[model samples]
Target chain A: MSSSSAAPTAKPPMRDALVAAAFRLFLDRGYEQTTVDDIVALAGVGRRSFFRYFPSKEDVVFPDHERCLTDMTAFLAGGEDEEHDPVARVCDAARMVLRMYAENPTFSVQRYRLTRRVPGLRAYELSVVWRYERALAEYLRSRFAGQTDGTLRADVIAAAVVAAHNNALRSWLRSDGEGDAGTLVDHALGHVQRAFGRPADAPVRAVPVRALPDEGDERPEDVVVLVSRRDAPVWRVVQEWEAALGRA
Target chain B: MSSSSAAPTAKPPMRDALVAAAFRLFLDRGYEQTTVDDIVALAGVGRRSFFRYFPSKEDVVFPDHERCLTDMTAFLAGGEDEEHDPVARVCDAARMVLRMYAENPTFSVQRYRLTRRVPGLRAYELSVVWRYERALAEYLRSRFAGQTDGTLRADVIAAAVVAAHNNALRSWLRSDGEGDAGTLVDHALGHVQRAFGRPADAPVRAVPVRALPDEGDERPEDVVVLVSRRDAPVWRVVQEWEAALGRA
Candidate 1:
């Protein structure tokens, strides 16, 4: 048996064939009803070969996610060498996923449809998506370390990035990948950038302060003006105020 | 057999005993090694009674998440009756999960430790958390339906709320729930509220804008002053400008 197996060494093509055969079987027979034997028989491979390529039947549906995740991590690591913004780097990492799906439209669309039908697969996909989000968050956490509200900012921005990326990805999947996925992802990601990203040369606009008309001759002797970025947390403003008061 | 099974009709104590017995068995003999039969035998209950309370052994560890999820959903539903802000409503819903954990500190902390050690349980917990986030996002989607960037706002805010809640919950759990969980949750949630929530009577502060010094004495006849909310989307600002130009 060992001698026989030596001739049919499991190569990349063999793995690809097994994955295609497994997906075909899953689509025809349904994910739950399909057995490992069915997949192996269709691929003309032994059970050992099937296990070598995929740990389980469900693993076949998402064969490339492990590679995709590794590639994303590498992309994020490479970004640290440049003068890139952390949020933009994370968005770029998410775009890698879009490129992967766009590369294989038919398989991606079919997998999306199949996953929507299977609760287990949906949960598995959610977990996978979460790992991607955590990678982004960890990267941002390092970038934002020592700043006030850094951890909260990291987690919130990571979640928002993932949500925005999924919004675009799901929209493309829903359309059967008919439109330009890159454009959809860019549009969706733009919302996050506008909300959180700070451009290097963003202009400061002056907002006019209007005072209420004085009621009769009881005029105020002094007027105190307060200003802050619309999105600044109250705690941060309070901290700034305390620092200034301490200086005084 | 049916008549005999009626003797141990699953009461609250039975469920509690089953959970306690399962956790003890899991600790003594690893989670992978512990069998349903072992749990039933340890608890001195029949297999049918064990299955009646839990669908599987893993379910024993996360016995109350289903109930907590239901309670959270119901709270969100009830909030719609009052004219509550959506972000505040979501934060209150998240507090429900904290209350569940706070109500059973030992079990919650034990489960958290167990889940951190077990990969499968961690994935299950992630899926459960995703469900909670989705429910919050759906509620926000309805509340912000007609506003600009409503869907994006709904998803981002929902994700932020969940992230903030989890940040506080995990901190308390890491400390073994010894401190005031409510105070920690409130402090974490305040970051989100300040970033996204609309206070009942939030003031619109007048920001005094300083004009840039002219490099050359090219005094323009007209000084165009444009003011918009800092957080408004660029497309919205453009639309407002277009509308104003059309009016002019």
Candidate 2:
């Protein structure tokens, strides 16, 4: 506990040492079975050093996510490139997250399995993912500050970005991180960007009604009554309604 | 402890009695301070009856969600209405969940407050919400079984529906459930139905690129060369790309 001398230059830092030792023991013994004392003893460090690196054992399981979130926040804040579309920027930020996991295939896969097996760790992981979603939402909120129900827009787009990224990340992780994580995330984020991207002056051809904000809140409710033959096919009735509504 | 005498007709069932007892004790004595014995004693029930009703203390915090999930499943399975758009059907299902919360505003608000104060309860609530999300995803998956990337579509839409519903639900809850929860959820789910409602033959008007499946996975990456003057604004450059892509 008294040794303050730095380790040799070839050695990993005390933080990485703690994480490595913790995961090693966590994999050997179950997460609940391993203790802080065991991690520090195996890492050849003090309990104080372990506490210095991680707040708790669960923190050790997810060491890189905070740094990734910080990087995403900083990337989203670097808005000097005013030309960048907000949706595109958020998608790029989401890619940075995917890249972080793709960087360490072995560790990422191990952590994924560990998280799935532990209920506490699974809840902790959801909280972390929620923070990432919040970051994306905050950035989008800043960009869409002027729009109606912009908060709602920001929340939906952020959830879509996180959900899509997660969908792809889980797929790649399940495959033991062998395939292109980038491609999966890109495909997923494309859905978000296309759904929320550009519309005002240059609307795309198939979604004229998508860009309108929720102005229906102020309008009185309309109950449409469609009169059709009872034996008419449902699709035919729907077709008639769609034609009447200019949606066919 | 063996009381064969039934309660009067005016009395609630033993299950409701347990929930009321648990919440009363949790709010008065704090969740950590209250025990199963305290709850059973407050409800004038035997220890065995408390265990029979709820498996754990956390289970008492969310008494109705399991039944609600079952009911949602039943409502969804009653889908012989082939005319119903899956997106619309799921949106209706989301409305049922909102109605559940709206029906009992006072108890819902008290529960919301209790959940926010207890970390364990909050995590449990997240798990319950996750189950709801899975149910929506399963229904969407069944409806979209044959389409390409149907699973991806199902997952994204499910998350979006849940997120949007939560957004509006929380807003209403924050107001102490005084306002109309239905309108808020309707406005939110409109975003989902618009982005994904009917695409192939009946695309509305603007969003030509939004409906295509992730077919680009098999195709070589698209590299569009947009030749614009060096001084052109970024929007102008983007415009050229959009023009060439036929998305404008």
Candidate 3:
């Protein structure tokens, strides 16, 4: 599908054309080898037009990022309705970002490749990602304004959501072909929720308290034995704990 | 004291000398006007020596960043003893970063100014900051392994700590003159801890529960009140329920 076919487009096709040409040239002749003039020539646009569309050659690689950021901000600011839970609102906000990447997987993949090779572009992308985190944090802060841990909670939640989104997006991009990006994003978000969403003050009334061991015994009060190492079996640790508790 | 009068010095004087020279030159003749040759000449070092010390002119502006990062990594990695308490370890790890910035306020101030003006340097600095967050998050994940919310907790703690550090550092730098930076850093770290250190899944046995009364011939069980704000006063809400129960 041609970009020109879109109806009532405020931006000229030359901008998208330049971006498409830049990606093609970058992939064909390498990012460093491909010049601004080459990109403009390939797109059949003049030198002046290229500059008008983009401040620098690098701008061609990440077209509409600013627009996406604005859209995300608007979406978040509009999520002030009291009907939804804070967690739901956060997930919806994260979805806005996932949808953006999913909408243009081809361009995103090309951009990811170029970013990997170019330190400057990679840094730029990171900065953009940080901005998203900032926006999300701000929204969460506003939503949880009266809480003592509002800012801290907001910051952590924002970071976790962004990290999960990034991890999933990177996995998708790394694969040779795109699959169910939506499902991946959902799964990633679930991972984040499970990781950080444990109720900080959940009722502990039902917790089974084991009695303290006798004095002069090896087992110390206030000490909980936990198995360390990644490959350690979960069942083994649980069994060991249960046996130790029995002895106590 | 001269840089060379070293007694197991933390950082070489030459590095400090180069940074000072670069900052002065950047301020005197804009960032773009300054050159690597000028910095080396001002620092009383040869071009070859400068090259040996720093890879590029930009490196001089952020001389101790790599060391700071290394120190932070070491601090986090050294927390194997407290592996079960990810929150405390992450807080302490973040404090090490604040200490690094406070150790050299003058150089940090100059670096901050340069970063603000030079887009390239800003991007570079951001990448380093992101790396610090990444390291903190990874360490948190390792420490919090097997917890239901381990990854999310790690991500949130890392992000909050970084944000708190940045906020404090920026405030210190923006002031007309420096104050007790250590105290400020402590205050910031405390804020972060209070926010994210609340033990997720910690027993909420301390929470007081209250039942509400029936109203207008409708059973209290039929009427449900939803709290959408995270900051809603739980104690007040409980008190209201207690009063309603008394009425019943």
lDDT of each: 0.75, 0.75, 0.67
Q: A180-234 in candidate 3: lDDT tens per residue?
A: 7778778878765543443232211111233367777675333223222222222
Error of 2 at A242 (Å): 17
Model 3 docking category: incorrect
Provide per-model DockQ scores: 0.30, 0.16, 0.12
The candidate that achieves the highest TM-score relative to the unseen native structure: 1
Q: Which residue runs does candidate 2 get wrong by more than 4 Å?
A: A1-12, A80-82, A199-248, B1-12, B80-82, B199-248
Name the runs in model 3 displaced over 4 angstroms: A1-7, A10-12, A77-91, A137-157, A175-179, A186-248, B1-10, B81-84, B144-153, B176-180, B187-248
Docking class of 2: incorrect
Instruction: Going through the candidates in order, state the TM-score of chain A alone for each one.
Output: 0.79, 0.76, 0.74
Provide the clash count, candidate 2. 9
- Residues A1-248, candidate 2, lDDT per residue (tens digit)? 10112335322488888989999999999999999999999999999988877898899999877777877888888862658788788888889888878878999999999999999899899888878888988998888888998878888888888888998999999999988999999998887776677422321121112222457665432222233322223233333334433541
How does chain B score by TM in each prediction? 0.79, 0.75, 0.75
Model 2: per-residue Cα lDDT over B36-129, one tens digit each: 9999999999999988867899998887777678778877787636676888888888887887788789889999998989988988888888
TM-score for chain B in model 2: 0.75
